[model samples]
Target: MNRNLTSQQKNAVLLSMAQLIAAEKAVIIKANKIDVESYRGEDIAMYDRLKVDEEKIEGMILSLQQLIADVDPVGKDLFHFTHENGLKITNKSAPFGTVLIIYESRPDVTVEAAGIAFKSGNKILLKGGKESLNSNLKIVNLWHKALIENNISTNWVEYLNYNRAKIQVFLENPTQKVDLIVPRGGEKLIAFVKQHATCPVIVSGRGNNFIYVDIEANLNLALKVILNAKTAKISACNAVDKVIINSNLIAKETFIKKLINKLLKFNVEILGDVELSAFENVSSFDSDEIWFKEFLDYKIVIGTVNSSEEAIAKINKYGGGHSAVIITKNDKTANTFMESVDSAAVYQNASTRFTDGGEFGLGGELAISTDKLHHRGPMGLQHLVTNKWYIYGDGQIR
Candidate 1:
């Protein structure tokens, strides 16, 4: 079991980490370049996440800084009770002991996830993909140095440089205690972790997000939100994959045509249902199975729904449970859509891209969880903790 550190101790380490990352930005970038060059996969989204640049370096530093500023989540009081016999009981937030995060492509998770776990007083075991070995190793080196500088154990953040077979073995029979496992990649990775790990798993699931343009929607706003959500960052998990337009929408054809044209400007491939297939450049999908797909690319599907109820039902049925957006001027309709959509994050007349930890003001997040138990949305520092019960008694018996 890992002993909890004082808030001051954790903050000191985070500060040191931010300073070191900023100071060694060049070295980090150089190491990242090696990882980028070695990656030969044709996955555009994976490639985008694999490459680390100056902007991403700044982002790492900022995440650490934010963690330093946020309140420590460990040992906070949750509930208190007093008994007639002078026995006292209290519940408080506690660390999960150890968190094993298995992630891919994104090296920044090295900084963000570990920092969040440490602040919550949990030891983090990172299992980064082989594609980002060099970059992740470099960041882990910085984490070690920061720990050493703060007179803390480097065991707080350890990296598992293992392949798929090794990871499976370790998960099936962990040499060390792993209280919780978080899989931060795609469906396959999540499935693998859940299959092998004996511990509880928090699934960072896919984002087959949706946007519904309602009859009362501001068509221009819908277009803007859709374009931004889809094209601004195609590699993001919150990127829009499907857009459902109300069948009764006034000037619906004009709006759809405009949306298609706007998307085409960015070289996005437009796919549609049978009704929308007549539009130029819009290819019709053969099956409804495509609705369940999370296209982390410059591709989108446009479909039509008869009413808000249909839209809600379809989104709940097909969406990734990550994010959904409803573009409408009617606050009542927006509220209905937002509440009906079964997603981690729901929006009204806003881009789905804002389904992020930083944007949601959690400072930063360990993961954008899709699970309902324990947590449902952004798993920030405060959300990373489990609870413990404390009892005070002087030889009291039942």
Candidate 2:
């Protein structure tokens, strides 16, 4: 079990962590190189996903510094009111005490989680995926050094050095002293955590994001948004996985041809339904399984919907509860889709790729949460803090 640190101590530790991240850029780059070299000759996708360069290292440091400078989320008063009986009540931020974050290959999550936990005044215990163990170890070591340098209890940022068996024990042990369990990875990992974890689990599920183009949408704008959303970075959670086009717009052959040409330019494989088979440029796929799949590559699934209502229903049925974007000039259609889709984040005339905490200017995020309870959408510093009510009253008692 890790020792709990006071808010003051946590803040000092965060400052030191930020400074260390900034000063040891070269060291971070070197550690990343070691991981990359070790991962060579493995699956190309896995290697690319695990490799970190100098640019990413600098970005991580900048994100840490930004988080350290941001206003602390804890201790902020959320609400305060006085009753007619003269009883005063106040709802303010409070830490969850100890947070257990189980994440995968993304080594950047170490700093992001640390910053959020530090700002929200909670002790963190991190267990990252085995693939990025070396990179994660380097990051954890730097943070531990920072905690020691700031005279804070290093246990506040505990790193689990155990194997899969120990992780299973940690998850299943009812006596484990974890206030909250945050699982950041694929559906399988999230499912495992949700099933076995005795603590309150926040499952950040896979993001099979979607974008809908209605009849009222501007073709040019839709094309631009779709291209960027799918091609910006396919491996990211926010990237577009499926695109639903209104059948009315699909009848416009010239527009469809132009769009297909543009998509093919980037080697983006298209899997469309029978209705879209007329477009000879793209490939086709059957059933809704394609919509549920997150390619995490240069691939996209396309479908045709009869109306905006149908599009909304399709997204709700197939989406992985991540993000959905509606591209429409009609305010009613856009607003209706936004309200109807039961996803974590919904956008109007914007790419689903923008459904990220970093894009929302929160420095960086712990994960893109698909769960509706506890935490949803982007898990950032604000989400790290919970609220508690403080009452101050005179002699009047309820």
Error of 2 at 144 (Å): 1.2
Question: Which stretches in model 2 have alpha-carbon errors above 4 Å?
Answer: 1-11, 40-46, 83-87, 174-176, 393-398
Per-candidate TM-scores read 0.99, 0.92
Enumerate residue pairs that collide in model 1.
none
Q: What TM value does model 2 have? A: 0.92
Highest TM-score model number = 1
Model 1 lDDT tens row, 44-152:
9999999889899999988888888888888899999999999899999999999999999999999999999999989999999999999999999999999999889
Would you list the C-alpha lDDT of every candidate in the order shown? Answer: 0.92, 0.81
